[model samples]
Target: MEENLRNNLIDKLQNNTISSEEREELFKLYNSYQFSKEWNENTMGNFEDVRKKILKGVKLKRNGASRGKIYAINSFLRIAAACLLVFFTGWLGYTLILKPDPNVIVESGKSRKEVVLPDGSKITMNINSTLTYPRVFEAKRREVKFEGEGFFEIQADRSHPFIVATPHVKVRVLGTAFNLKAYKEDPAIETSLIHGKVEVLTAKEERTLSILTPNHKFVVDKIALITSHLPQTKSQIEVVPMEFIDPSNTAPVDLAWKEGKFAFASSPFQDIAREMKRRYAVDIIFENKEAADFKYTASFEQEDVVDILDALQLVKPFKYRKEGNKIVVY
Candidate 1:
């Protein structure tokens, strides 16, 4: 596209006068520019150049102004610097604000990430999770694809219902705060609501499985559904109250991981080990089959993996040893 045409299209977008065809043309241009060699080579250098100019301006004006005046001047300079930085950073601002393609965010190893959507909804992703969302939602609905686990604080839009699609289930809500765990290796998919209401639905059929209220959880038994040989019609699901370690404080066990705390209630040893493997970036091997099926409840905050293993042994009397990079339990 020509520079004049690009500027004209951008002006139309800013004034909310761009037709659908023009928007499509702008998106195609952005997509082409994103993959060009110029974008790859010049982005970082342009950012550095803009940063230096902003810093030079700040230092030059600091000595000439009063304290109050300097504060105001610095604030104005910051805003100007941001505008200049965005202008020179190629089409990044435009892509983030106007692109039609979905954006994928992945959190791997032991790290967590916080993502804010275009509509101001917040998502805090757990380790080994992936979320895919568009830069902007459609006029009629807001939707995203998710896997693993995430804590969502959705922005309320009654006209456009927010939907989260996982492999096994879907969660629909108007505006709510909730934690959804749908790890592939886990036995079940758990959706725990903190506040507001949500409708849980079947992924394949889009059938309503359950409606959840605050301090409640909806669970889908994935293992049972997968293993059953007969023609399965209804999914084995359960609705239960959220677990609280202390009734006085009323903190849900589902949200403990967000606080850097691991809390489990009568969870299987193999399932706990899988979570530990992701959280600590270590492999756990079970030499004894009985140990893998052992049920235990435990909670720890900021403890080393070895310390947690040792603590668990004191209660259940299981033996485990570190063998190179893997922890072997017998």
Candidate 2:
């Protein structure tokens, strides 16, 4: 083979791409290369290591695998990572299931919705999230109740702190973008900050005062008066001081729902049903107990309940039927 052929082969091999014949040709060429043995020792390794490294590094974009075989290495690692990406149907699912706001966001279902509020935090409820709030608020004390969830970029008026109160806890924020999860049956209340500061208060006690900067988060236990705060700063710029919630590291994932999508994080079936009912304008009732425990972690956009049920069946097999306006999950 010519030098150019060798170079091209090297490129493909490095990128984990080769046809059956190409693989055989590459094996012969790679061995013939100068110091090729050393190169192999240094570059190539078991597939698992490669896959973990790749998956951990770049989150491939959705829109099907047009990623070519570029920058890939032929190893079990590539196979595993590619399998995961393919299994999920793509990498980055911009189109997500507009899940119920964990805090209190009323979602419009297959119909138009208008959400009036106490402090004039007017939110236009989209299909699928049942949101409830007080008609008003008082000073040194601000509370609005909600179920499901919503993506909020609060209108800042620092004097009256905006608190999205649920039965379990409250997510308080002033002038910032974030997503909250306070479903009725969830074991914990999760608040993720996309920008700005927020505090989660329980038992009306603000001790240690879980203060969260951007990208940082504070999750409160539903029953227990405890709080959990994860590290938010970057690992590389440790010396440099900056605050932002790393969407790449938080769970219940990012909030692309308001933009019309559903984003779940291994959430319970019941919670998922509640979100669907609000968004699709259809009711999701559990017909079977076994299905309720089924957990899911995926995203979609304006998907019907059948698709949702199909996804649920992936984790926990069950039966179901439709009852007029409701989905009976058995």
TM-score for all predictions? 0.65, 0.45
lDDT of candidate 1 over 160-251, digit per residue (tens): 99999998888999999999999977878999999999998878633677899898888878765453334462446678888876667477
Give the per-residue lDDT of model 2 (tens digit) for 1-330. 455675565556557674445545555554454625344434455434543433332333221233444434446578988899886764344324443333444555565355656565655444444766544454665656666555666777788788776676667777676666666655655666777887766535444335666765455555454323333321211111222223555433545455566767666788777767656667777768777877877777777678877876777788888889877866
RMSD (CA, angstroms), candidate 1: 27.9
Q: State how far residue 231 of model 2 sits from its true place (Å).
A: 22
The 10 consecutive residues of candidate 1 with the worst lDDT sum are 35-44
TM-score of 1: 0.65
Candidate 1 local lDDT, residue 47? 34
Those runs of model 1 whose alpha carbons end farther than 4 Å from true positions after fitting are 1-109, 223-235, 247-249
The clash tally of candidate 2 reads 42
Instruction: Report lDDT per candidate.
Output: 0.79, 0.59
How does model 2 fare in lDDT?
0.59
Which pairs clash in model 1? none
